[model samples]
Target chain A: MSTQAIIAIGVFLITYAFIVTEKIHRTIIAMAGGIMMVLLGIIGQEKALQHIDFNTLGLLTGMMIIVAITAETGLFKYIAIWAAKKVKGDPLKILVVLGIITALGSAFLDNVTTVLLMVPVTFSITRQLRVNPIPFLITEVIASNIGGTSTLIGDPPNIMLGSAVKELTFMAFINNLTAISFFILFVNIAILAFIYRKQLRTSAELMANLMDMDEKEEITDKTLLRKSLIALTVTILGFFLHQLLHIESATVALTGAFLLLLLTGEKYLDKAFLKVEWTTIFFFIGLFVLVSGLIETGVISKLADYSVHLTGGDVKSTAILILWVSAIASAFIDNIPFVATMIPMIKDMGELGVSNLEPLWWSLSLGACLGGNGTLIGASANVIVAGLAAKEGHSITFGKFLLIAFPLMILSIIICTVYIYFRYLI
Target chain B: MNVAYKYDEKLLELKETANGDDIEFLITLFDSELKKRLIKVREFFEDNKILTDIHYYIHPNNKYQIIVRKDFYNEFLIQLFRQELLQEIKWR
Candidate 1:
């Protein structure tokens, strides 16, 4: 390796170490590493800028704005309270109903936002029934991750993958992963029910208390809710027709955000824009530059060559290898950068005569998205839910979360492994 | 009758010149609202058929003294002064 190549690798490793340790803010770490890559001349400024995937950033920001406005209308709270009522305060029934809502919500809306809406109301319901909120929270986290696997806009990793591979469309992601995601979601519910069977029971009086709550009171702003919902529906339609319209997903998302801002009145523009997770966006930018350095140094191609060699150039073996490795690595590390780095390597493999790259992309998608359930820190949604729980005095320790999460995560991966094998590898 | 309320240290003091029946009604309203908003208090209300361990001082100076528990005090005040409830009671 050349001196510059060695420096690039060093910077990448150090940045990854910081990310994994999570002592410092990930955005800061990523930004510092990205700057180092440019300063070290591993990749020039323009090339680094080129590497940043604005499509993914744009989608995230736009969706965040929509969610922010929608949340302000108390729509998510309304859904949660409504789901709680539907179960009649039956703890297990509440689990299943809320789990499904979370899965579907995460699929359509992003996972973190879905959980942000679901968790507090979950806490409220569980507290009313005198049950531990851990099981429900854990199930929601897992469901969010699985549901996020099903669509281009569902999860950050999927968003990254979708933007990186132009051929991977909105419907393509839905068609490929939705069934598997639902399968995993059902398995998740079963496991949670069995594990918490003792805690998932409540009395008639508790049910009566819950029934008395006026769910309509949860809707803080009905007019804003209507406007936000319309904008969201239009945006989703835009995503579906983007291919036909020859428009980018980013443009579609930004249009929806701006339209909602206008419809909801220009006064909310500042609050809606502020709701965008700038830290996350900057983190993606920094990660792209660092990975771009690896690409510029030919490290990604060499790694792809190494992977090809290990699989003996067999497509099935390569797909399984990527799926399993991505699953395990994503459980510990942030999957965004992992997917970002793998995108180029997989592309390199395609150039190196890997006939079918579609299966590999699917494998990466399933593995990375589902693998987030393995640990508390594995995904942004997990950490946010955990923090919320702790603030409410129901702290979910890392060990406690992993005790259930790790086994369940492994089971989900196994299911994914089988599904990928049958659907693609054969 | 006029009613004045203030938070001092860990206590919520209410000075009411209302008749006993009216004061009783307000207390009931306060308890129900607390049960609705604060989960901890709701759990207590469910277990015991009354508000949990709520102590009050019946004196001229502190007409009603609520010994707000440290944990539930913040939520207690939040519920008592919530805009909608305040509007309903014409306190806002």
Candidate 2:
């Protein structure tokens, strides 16, 4: 191999190692690597930033703002109570409800936010019911990964994939629903069934005393509540309108978020914005630059050739290969960067001599999103869920998360592969 | 600015006094629509007997910051009220 290629390989491996050990925070390491890439002269600063995918960044930031606003509504805690009650002293039902709501929420919102909103509630409910929160929390981790796989804005990887190619519009995503949703859903449900059959049957009450917490909330001004409703209703309507008008999702989300800030006249607007997680944005920016280093150093073309050879020039074969590999690798390393690196590689697969691998894009998207379930580190969404749940003292250990997440991830990928081959590749 | 000066006496000092992780969540402009929507959610909580962890608010200054988790400061709410008083602000 060439010297530049060797050096690039070294950089990738080092990043990979740090990610796996996770002794060093991934965000810090990523930011440092992003800086290193620029200093090393591997890529120019502007070019590196260009790779950052502002659209994805904007979408995430916008949604986070919305979540920040909505989280205050007592919506999540209220649901937590509902889940605890519905389980009706049944541990299994609690597990199922956690999974279902997580999936649904992740579909509309990003997975990390969904998990962030749910985890604390999950912990408190489980703690009150005197049942282990581990299983229910883990199920949420899996469900978020699976459910977030389908939508363009649901997961970071999908957003990356969307920006990687402009032709892959928001509408195109919904149009391809058969592959993204139905395909992923069946596998998700199957995995949940296999893991929680016994838990579902158990009569262990996980949240018996949770109702008292719900009774204390006072609502004195009925009029103020009415105004807030108008803002929310208008926001949803704006989202659809923007989608049709081809306005970026980020713009729509940000508009909604800012509008709320104006309407409420909250004293803590800055605090809410501050809570938006700038670290996550920095991670994406740095990761984008780091991946650009690979491309600038001629590493992308080389890897593309290798990937094409591995699939033996068959599109179907390449799709399956990319899908499975992405799914597996993402479980161990964060999928956003992994998927980011693969986009150029796959784009090259078809850009040159590797014909018919066009469908590989969808494969990668499906793989990266679904792959998030295999390990806590696989997706940022998983890590946040794990971290947040742990903070709530529910103790979602890496080992336990993987124990549930891995099998479900594998099954979901298998299902995705089948659906893709029949619907697109075959 | 059309300053619509409105304040809930219960939280007049919210600008200075803050306590509990959830105290910030209680302050915002209820105006009619938001209150009704919140009532449905409250009823849902009431039916289930769940405790209120945070009070909801919609900031009129920046409409996107709906569901404010912080208490409404008097100064800020006055500015929002003044917004209606201001002729330039248009409500869709």
Lowest lDDT sum, 10 consecutive residues, model 2 chain A, at: A203-212
Local accuracy of candidate 2 as per-residue lDDT tens digits, A247-302? 77667667777777777677538756877888888888878877888888888988
Which candidate gets the maximum TM-score versus the true structure? Answer: 1
Q: Give me the candidate number with maximum lDDT.
A: 1
**Model 2: how far residue A194 lies from native, Å:** 5.8
* Cα-based lDDT at residue B33, candidate 1: 39
Candidate 2, residue A329: CA error in Å? 0.2
Inter-residue clash pairs, candidate 1: none
Task: Give model 1's docking category.
Answer: incorrect
